[model samples]
Target: MVFKKFTNGCVNLVNKYLPDAFLFAIVLTIIVFLAGMGITQQTPMAMVKHWGTGFWSLLSFSMQMVLVLVLGTAMAKAPVFERLLTAIAMSAKTPGRAVVITAVVATVACWLNWGFGLIIGVLIAKEMAKRVKGVDYRLLIATGYAGMIVWHGGISGSIPLQIASGSAESLAQQTAGALTAQVPTSETIFAPFNLIICLLFLIFLPLVAHAMMPTKENTVTVDPRIFEEPPAPPAHKFTPAENFERNRVMWIITLALGYIYIVYNLVTTNFNLGLNIVNMIFLFVGLTLHGNLRRYIDALMASASTAGGIILQFPFYAGIMGMMTGVSAATGTSLAQVISNAFVSIATPVTFPLFTYLSAGIVNLFVPSGGGQWAVQGPIMMPAGVALGVKPAVTAMGIAWGDAWTNMIQPFWALPALGIAGLSARDIMGYCVIVLIMGGIITSAVFLLFGGMGWF
Candidate 1:
């Protein structure tokens, strides 16, 4: 009875505050502990090693975050860019339509860079909300962020994964060689398809939400103050040199890229240094680029503050991966058998992609990071696809589709979106839920059709 009471109290407290963090900690701890106990195939020490791996992984995560903040801030302050984004968000009048536009814009930005995508989408949604009255701003914000989920599936997303996979230099060379192989590039074709699908989504989503809007015609009161806030002043207010120096975040990303360039060239040239040593050098450079000793102290604190949730969850995720990998290694075809059995049971070939899409969507709930999810799921799915006679790229695309569509409703990405828009999930839930459901259905259908026809 005492134990039950303690558990209930803990649950209630967690439900009220830090729900995501609490859930991550609990799930990860249970998984890691079980793996450690040898209840799963993995030994505890393997899990420990995985946790140690996070020390390096977290640095990459930090680099991505810093890049996101700098790009976001740049987009937010750029007048021409801001106007273009706002126009995109406001293109569709209905809340659902607005969300589709937001998602497309976000996805495109994410394709270029995930961090920039989040910043631009959130900023645009916020601006649109300020201009329009009675619209659900939260939904728009969620829609904008949804685009970020698929970034890892795009061409640019391949780079970091290649690096982590220990194939970065080779992949970079291969990509460069393939650059001139196509007229417009594969990404160009995919971009238009994505845009068209988003347009279709915007058109249909409003009809779905029409039932939810207030029925009676009421006086539309437009706030004059909405129009009164002048546009952001010129960039001259902050000089170019000051902009570069003040935003240490940008410099970190630049340095990281430089490090990547050096590593790529060195590896291709058959240089001797290990990948670990290269990463260490980059970490040192990241630390040194901050300049002032005091600033480094503050940055350490700031980084910890921002990464608290991520750090807390790392052990558990690592544990889960350890257990899963162990199972795969021991059972030989066990994982493949399970997936193949699932695939065989599906009625049609189209159903296979649909299943892949839905499976990816479910995974996104727990693993929100696109690159991370790919790291975890990619290997499993690749062999599973071979066993099931599905193309690996098609399965990969399905994973991407699933990752992108669910970002609409997931609170992980929504926090930044909400922060920028001054809205809550509750405020946006009504509209975002509709977009999510619709987009998920549409995206799944697209994947299924493409996979079945071998169009991907």
Candidate 2:
């Protein structure tokens, strides 16, 4: 009952107070602009210049992010995956089971690819809600978001993968001691400690979400009609061009060609799974699952509006990142330095990863982009980790987890999921706050114990 009250109160508070994501981005841009003026030696004009120049710095990265969400969402809506989700959702006859299964499936998807997990989670929740009567709509959405909790520690975590890739070596140009060599996934994503924490959350998060479900009288449910998917249009006689567009023969050829490229990539790259490759993998898998050009195109078209919100908001964050990073030498200390040093001051061998995690969480709120955040804090944190005797991989993972940790409350990463759910951040975030707290505790304990044990 105490938890129930807290959840309800939180929901009410957030829904009432929080602004739309666009406004939130605008506020962050203003805050960072002012913060740069105060903390750095740059003149107002210089700061404006920095913001302008940096606004488009993430153009390539921004496209990659957009595709991940757009393509993944497109893939999930394909009939093959839809039927699969519906079949699974049918087994969840009770509201409690529906929420748990949604979390489990989302967690598994997120563990594989954050984009995949985010889209699939929302779609699955909608399907489950349609099949199962009486589930709290808000909690179901929250459960879908909650399953993404494990993404940072999962295979597609940005920081961990950044350090693993050859491209991370370019960071040395920015800071004196940023990592100049690749760090392997074995040390971070696949580490024993990380795996242990992930497994525990898989078992634990569902029970907590299930228990948090509101009572029947207090539950917030919408008419199931809202959850209903519109039926696909029936096929009719077609012209040659239309027939060619819908032809399964061409789709089969496309699928075969896509698989060949994917196979060649895996073989030549020695199974390297970078962001672009991951997106391509999703593309092929999505095409095959979708089974034809016309169906796949329809799914893709449905994803555009859901993706456009995130696309519009990312530039503001890039501007903020630019103003924060492009500091004048005369200021004598960068905000990134001050932020990193705050945690570094108290860090020792046993506690370094914890502080790194905390600092990354703070930086993440302001900087938001995982790659962008790392480019700032990574330089400072990487050397500090080596000095304090935390393995580079552990330190890297610490930052990765920290980046992912605060995302439960950070609205940027939730854009895809929220857009698909037709809800705002407030509808889902109150429950995510609970997850943020639980994940922080579990992750911190694991980091400390493992660092002490020399596990990773």
- Top of the candidates by TM-score: 2
- Model 2 clash tally, residue pairs: 0
lDDT of 1: 0.50
* Highest lDDT scorer: 2
Candidate 2: 10-residue stretch with minimal lDDT = 168-177
Off by over 4 Å in 2: 167-175, 178-181, 231-235, 451-456
Candidate 2 per-residue C-alpha lDDT over 1-456 given as tens digits, one digit per residue, 9 for 90 to 100 = 898888777777888888888888888888877777777766788879878988888778778878877787778777778788889999998999999998899889888877667777888888887788899988888888777778888987877776676564474553356567777888888888889989988987898788788788878787878756688679778899988998988898988888899889989976756678888877888888887898788878877777777788888878888887786767666666777888999998999998899898888887777777778887788888888777888888788888888888888888877877788887878788888888899889988888788766
Cα lDDT, model 1, residue 170: 48
What lDDT score is found at residue 42 in candidate 2? 66
How many residue pairs clash in all the candidates, one count each?
0, 0
TM-score of each: 0.58, 0.92
